[model samples]
Target: SSLTPRPTGGISPIALPVLESLFTGNLQEARKLVFSQMLVSGQAAENGGSNNFIIGKRNQRALQVLSKSVDQDNCKTNALLYGGMHCKDLHRRLESMGYVAKKTEWRTAWSVD
Candidate 1:
Protein backbone atom coordinates (compact mmCIF):
# COMPACT_ATOMS: atom_id res chain seq x y z
CA SER A 1 0.00 0.00 0.00
CA SER A 2 1.21 3.48 -0.82
CA LEU A 3 1.51 5.98 1.98
CA THR A 4 -0.22 9.34 1.61
CA PRO A 5 1.97 12.38 2.11
CA ARG A 6 0.98 15.16 4.44
CA PRO A 7 1.45 18.78 3.44
CA THR A 8 4.21 20.52 5.34
CA GLY A 9 3.72 24.10 6.42
CA GLY A 10 6.43 26.57 5.43
CA ILE A 11 8.23 28.70 7.97
CA SER A 12 10.33 31.80 7.47
CA PRO A 13 12.48 33.84 9.81
CA ILE A 14 11.15 37.30 10.65
CA ALA A 15 13.23 40.42 9.93
CA LEU A 16 14.25 42.70 12.79
CA PRO A 17 15.09 46.19 11.47
CA VAL A 18 11.94 46.46 9.38
CA LEU A 19 9.93 45.59 12.46
CA GLU A 20 11.77 48.23 14.48
CA SER A 21 11.17 50.94 11.91
CA LEU A 22 7.46 50.23 11.77
CA PHE A 23 7.01 50.25 15.52
CA THR A 24 9.05 53.45 15.64
CA GLY A 25 6.63 55.16 13.20
CA ASN A 26 9.05 55.42 10.32
CA LEU A 27 6.84 54.69 7.31
CA GLN A 28 9.39 55.30 4.58
CA GLU A 29 11.97 53.22 6.36
CA ALA A 30 9.29 50.68 7.16
CA ARG A 31 8.47 50.35 3.45
CA LYS A 32 12.07 49.75 2.53
CA LEU A 33 12.61 47.37 5.41
CA VAL A 34 9.48 45.41 4.63
CA PHE A 35 10.36 45.02 0.93
CA SER A 36 13.89 43.89 1.77
CA GLN A 37 12.74 41.50 4.46
CA MET A 38 10.20 39.93 2.13
CA LEU A 39 12.97 39.24 -0.34
CA VAL A 40 15.15 37.68 2.35
CA SER A 41 12.45 35.68 4.13
CA GLY A 42 12.49 33.11 1.25
CA GLN A 43 8.83 32.63 0.66
CA ALA A 44 7.91 32.72 -3.05
CA ALA A 45 4.81 34.66 -2.19
CA GLU A 46 3.40 36.47 0.77
CA ASN A 47 1.40 34.18 3.01
CA GLY A 48 -1.23 36.13 4.88
CA GLY A 49 -1.20 36.27 8.68
CA SER A 50 2.37 35.07 8.89
CA ASN A 51 2.28 38.19 11.03
CA ASN A 52 -1.33 39.41 11.30
CA PHE A 53 -1.63 40.94 14.76
CA ILE A 54 1.42 43.10 14.32
CA ILE A 55 0.36 44.25 10.86
CA GLY A 56 -3.20 45.00 11.90
CA LYS A 57 -1.95 47.04 14.86
CA ARG A 58 0.68 48.92 12.88
CA ASN A 59 -1.77 49.48 10.06
CA GLN A 60 -3.93 51.30 12.53
CA ARG A 61 -0.93 53.48 13.31
CA ALA A 62 -0.16 54.05 9.63
CA LEU A 63 -3.75 55.11 9.17
CA GLN A 64 -3.27 57.66 11.91
CA VAL A 65 -0.19 58.93 10.06
CA LEU A 66 -1.92 59.15 6.69
CA SER A 67 -5.61 59.18 7.33
CA LYS A 68 -6.50 58.14 3.78
CA SER A 69 -3.76 55.59 3.37
CA VAL A 70 -6.02 52.55 3.48
CA ASP A 71 -9.53 51.86 2.43
CA GLN A 72 -12.40 51.77 4.88
CA ASP A 73 -13.08 48.14 4.04
CA ASN A 74 -13.04 45.59 6.83
CA CYS A 75 -12.90 41.82 6.97
CA LYS A 76 -12.62 39.02 9.51
CA THR A 77 -9.43 37.10 10.27
CA ASN A 78 -10.37 34.11 8.13
CA ALA A 79 -10.93 36.38 5.14
CA LEU A 80 -7.71 38.29 5.81
CA LEU A 81 -5.63 35.15 6.27
CA TYR A 82 -6.56 33.63 2.94
CA GLY A 83 -7.29 36.84 1.11
CA GLY A 84 -4.26 36.96 -1.26
CA MET A 85 -1.02 38.78 -2.17
CA HIS A 86 -2.29 42.21 -1.22
CA CYS A 87 -3.17 40.84 2.17
CA LYS A 88 0.31 39.32 2.38
CA ASP A 89 1.95 42.65 1.56
CA LEU A 90 -0.13 44.34 4.20
CA HIS A 91 0.72 41.64 6.72
CA ARG A 92 4.46 41.75 5.96
CA ARG A 93 4.56 45.50 6.37
CA LEU A 94 2.81 45.28 9.72
CA GLU A 95 4.88 42.33 10.95
CA SER A 96 8.16 44.11 10.25
CA MET A 97 7.12 47.17 12.16
CA GLY A 98 5.61 45.44 15.15
CA TYR A 99 7.95 42.48 15.67
CA VAL A 100 9.70 42.40 19.03
CA ALA A 101 13.15 40.99 19.55
CA LYS A 102 13.61 38.48 22.29
CA LYS A 103 16.18 35.99 23.60
CA THR A 104 15.00 32.58 24.65
CA GLU A 105 16.65 29.42 25.95
CA TRP A 106 14.86 26.25 25.05
CA ARG A 107 14.50 23.22 27.29
CA THR A 108 13.06 19.85 26.48
CA ALA A 109 9.35 19.94 25.91
CA TRP A 110 6.98 17.80 27.95
CA SER A 111 3.84 17.85 25.92
CA VAL A 112 0.44 17.35 27.44
CA ASP A 113 -0.69 16.87 23.87
Candidate 2:
Protein backbone atom coordinates (compact mmCIF):
# COMPACT_ATOMS: atom_id res chain seq x y z
CA SER A 1 0.00 0.00 0.00
CA SER A 2 1.23 3.41 -0.93
CA LEU A 3 1.69 5.43 2.22
CA THR A 4 -0.88 8.12 2.56
CA PRO A 5 0.09 11.36 4.25
CA ARG A 6 -1.43 11.53 7.66
CA PRO A 7 -0.24 14.94 8.73
CA THR A 8 -1.79 14.36 12.11
CA GLY A 9 0.33 11.24 12.53
CA GLY A 10 3.94 12.17 12.13
CA ILE A 11 5.38 9.84 14.78
CA SER A 12 3.01 9.87 17.74
CA PRO A 13 1.19 6.73 16.70
CA ILE A 14 4.32 4.70 17.21
CA ALA A 15 6.13 6.78 19.80
CA LEU A 16 3.22 7.14 22.18
CA PRO A 17 2.30 3.48 22.32
CA VAL A 18 5.91 2.39 22.52
CA LEU A 19 6.58 4.95 25.22
CA GLU A 20 3.55 3.81 27.14
CA SER A 21 4.76 0.26 27.05
CA LEU A 22 8.20 1.28 28.20
CA PHE A 23 6.83 3.43 30.98
CA THR A 24 4.86 0.44 32.22
CA GLY A 25 8.11 -1.56 32.37
CA ASN A 26 7.07 -3.75 29.49
CA LEU A 27 10.31 -3.94 27.57
CA GLN A 28 9.20 -6.86 25.44
CA GLU A 29 6.00 -5.11 24.45
CA ALA A 30 7.90 -1.94 23.67
CA ARG A 31 10.30 -3.85 21.44
CA LYS A 32 7.44 -5.45 19.57
CA LEU A 33 5.75 -2.12 19.10
CA VAL A 34 8.93 -0.59 17.71
CA PHE A 35 9.38 -3.29 15.09
CA SER A 36 5.72 -3.18 14.12
CA GLN A 37 5.67 0.57 13.75
CA MET A 38 9.04 0.55 12.01
CA LEU A 39 7.48 -1.47 9.22
CA VAL A 40 4.70 1.05 8.82
CA SER A 41 7.10 3.98 8.98
CA GLY A 42 9.44 2.35 6.46
CA GLN A 43 6.57 1.82 4.06
CA ALA A 44 5.53 5.42 4.40
CA ALA A 45 9.01 6.72 3.70
CA GLU A 46 9.53 4.38 0.77
CA ASN A 47 6.19 5.06 -0.85
CA GLY A 48 5.02 8.60 -0.22
CA GLY A 49 4.47 11.81 1.77
CA SER A 50 6.55 14.33 3.72
CA ASN A 51 9.27 11.91 4.77
CA ASN A 52 11.89 14.61 5.24
CA PHE A 53 9.68 16.56 7.56
CA ILE A 54 8.94 13.48 9.59
CA ILE A 55 12.56 12.44 9.71
CA GLY A 56 13.58 15.96 10.67
CA LYS A 57 11.23 15.98 13.58
CA ARG A 58 12.48 12.60 14.76
CA ASN A 59 16.08 13.73 14.48
CA GLN A 60 15.34 16.88 16.43
CA ARG A 61 13.82 14.88 19.23
CA ALA A 62 16.70 12.45 19.32
CA LEU A 63 19.22 15.26 19.47
CA GLN A 64 17.34 16.85 22.31
CA VAL A 65 17.66 13.67 24.30
CA LEU A 66 21.31 13.33 23.40
CA SER A 67 21.94 16.88 24.44
CA LYS A 68 20.37 16.25 27.80
CA SER A 69 22.43 13.15 28.33
CA VAL A 70 25.60 15.07 27.64
CA ASP A 71 24.79 18.28 29.47
CA GLN A 72 22.79 17.03 32.40
CA ASP A 73 24.06 13.52 32.86
CA ASN A 74 27.66 14.41 32.13
CA CYS A 75 27.95 11.55 29.70
CA LYS A 76 31.50 11.11 28.50
CA THR A 77 30.56 8.83 25.65
CA ASN A 78 27.38 8.06 23.81
CA ALA A 79 26.25 6.22 20.74
CA LEU A 80 23.49 7.14 18.36
CA LEU A 81 22.26 4.83 15.71
CA TYR A 82 19.86 6.31 13.20
CA GLY A 83 18.92 5.91 9.56
CA GLY A 84 21.58 7.02 7.10
CA MET A 85 19.27 9.62 5.61
CA HIS A 86 19.43 11.46 8.93
CA CYS A 87 23.21 11.57 9.06
CA LYS A 88 23.70 14.85 7.27
CA ASP A 89 21.41 16.79 9.50
CA LEU A 90 22.65 15.05 12.63
CA HIS A 91 26.25 15.71 11.71
CA ARG A 92 25.45 19.38 11.32
CA ARG A 93 23.70 19.48 14.64
CA LEU A 94 26.50 17.71 16.47
CA GLU A 95 29.09 19.96 14.88
CA SER A 96 27.12 22.99 15.91
CA MET A 97 27.32 21.64 19.42
CA GLY A 98 31.13 21.46 19.04
CA TYR A 99 31.21 17.71 18.44
CA VAL A 100 33.49 16.13 15.88
CA ALA A 101 33.32 12.66 14.52
CA LYS A 102 35.96 10.49 16.11
CA LYS A 103 35.39 7.46 13.95
CA THR A 104 32.85 6.00 11.61
CA GLU A 105 32.15 2.42 10.61
CA TRP A 106 29.47 1.03 8.37
CA ARG A 107 28.10 -2.44 8.91
CA THR A 108 25.60 -3.56 6.35
CA ALA A 109 22.34 -4.58 7.95
CA TRP A 110 21.05 -5.87 4.61
CA SER A 111 21.38 -5.31 0.92
CA VAL A 112 19.27 -6.32 -2.07
CA ASP A 113 20.41 -6.81 -5.59
Worst 10 residues of 1 by lDDT: 75-84
List residue ranges in candidate 1 displaced over 4 A. Answer: 1-14, 42-113
Clashing pairs in 1: 19-96, 55-94
Best by lDDT: 2
Residue-wise C-alpha lDDT for candidate 2, range 4-69, written one tens digit per residue? 336876545447667767778989888877786786677667543577778778888999999999
Please report the TM-score between candidate 1 and the true structure. Answer: 0.23
Per-residue lDDT over 61-85 for candidate 1, one digit per residue giving the tens place of the 0 to 100 score: 6534433333343322111222222
Clashes of 2: 0
Residue pairs clashing in model 2 are: none
